[model samples]
Target: MALVASLCNRVIVMYAGRIVEQGPTRAIFKNPQHPYTWSLLRSMPRMDEVGKERLVSIRGVPPDLGKLPTGCKFHPRCRFKVDRCLTEEPPLGEVDPEQLARCWVLMKNVSNPEMQS
Candidate 1:
């Protein structure tokens, strides 16, 4: 997944047949807004830190698509989950003009300094 992301000009992260985030590859890599994207990126092994640090990994198994959890399908594995994440489905909102993510965190604040629209 990380390798594919590096080669694409734009990337869309999907979970349970739904888009969780979509944006320019650089923007997504530079500042991932969704918890799932952040976790996926961090979980990849980096050549620069091959021996410097242990590779990170996202905990838990992928959710079953047929019986996805209520609200955000990823809330079950997301370490940064909040109360709303467990019960409210976040809509895909603009993080920037070219970027849209289905996350309450980004929707609540579109003018984030790191990825301003």
Candidate 2:
């Protein structure tokens, strides 16, 4: 991920063989729109931390690709999942001028306490 952050100009986050989020590397890292992307960023170790901070782990295991979930493949494990997410797969929509995400609950609409720092 450090290598990706340093060497890539763009990033495309995928889940269940589908693109969940895509954008400029900095934009995606600084402000992820999809819940999966947010969870992934949270799980990474930060170099600037002062103490031995435990990384956050995304709960639940990945769904079987052969027998994928009904709606969003990530809904079963997503903390920010809504009723719509369970029944309807969100399209890859524009999050900003340079970002696109596939999620019913965009991170911008939610108050993520972790991102406060």
Candidate 3:
């Protein structure tokens, strides 16, 4: 991510052979709307934290590629899992001119306060 942030103009986030989000690097880093993006950022070591601090990590195991789950592949590990997430695969929808995201809840309301929703 640090490398991508420094060198790439755009970013594409993929999970389970599917694209979760794509946008200008600054836009995606500054305002990540998807649950996967939120979790990923949270799992990184904070620059503001003092030395010897613990780094956060994403929970749950990565899904098997060959035998993937139905619907939204990320649903099983996502804290924001909803009923729709289990059965309905969300399409990549434009969040802005350059940003796109794939998540039923985020598609409904990217501005949702609780990222865990």
TM agreement with the true structure for every prediction: 0.82, 0.92, 0.85
Ranking under lDDT, best-scoring first?
Answer: 2, 3, 1
lDDT of 2 by residue, 1-117 (tens): 889999999999999999999999999999999989998998998989846787878889999999998889999999888899988999999998889999989999998546533
lDDT of 1 by residue, 46-107 (tens): 87888886655677899988889998888888766678988999999888898888987653
Off by over 4 Å in 2: 50-52, 113-117
Per-residue lDDT of 26 in model 3? 97
Q: For residue 71, what is the lDDT in candidate 1? A: 85
Q: Tell me the TM-score of model 1.
A: 0.82
Candidate 3, position 90, lDDT: 91
Alpha-carbon lDDT, every model:
0.78, 0.91, 0.82
Q: What's the true lDDT of residue 56 in model 2?
A: 79
Screening candidate 3 with a backbone cut-off below 3 angstroms (N, C-alpha, C), the clashing residue pairs are none
RMSD, one per candidate, in order: 5.2, 2.5, 2.9
Give the best candidate by lDDT. 2
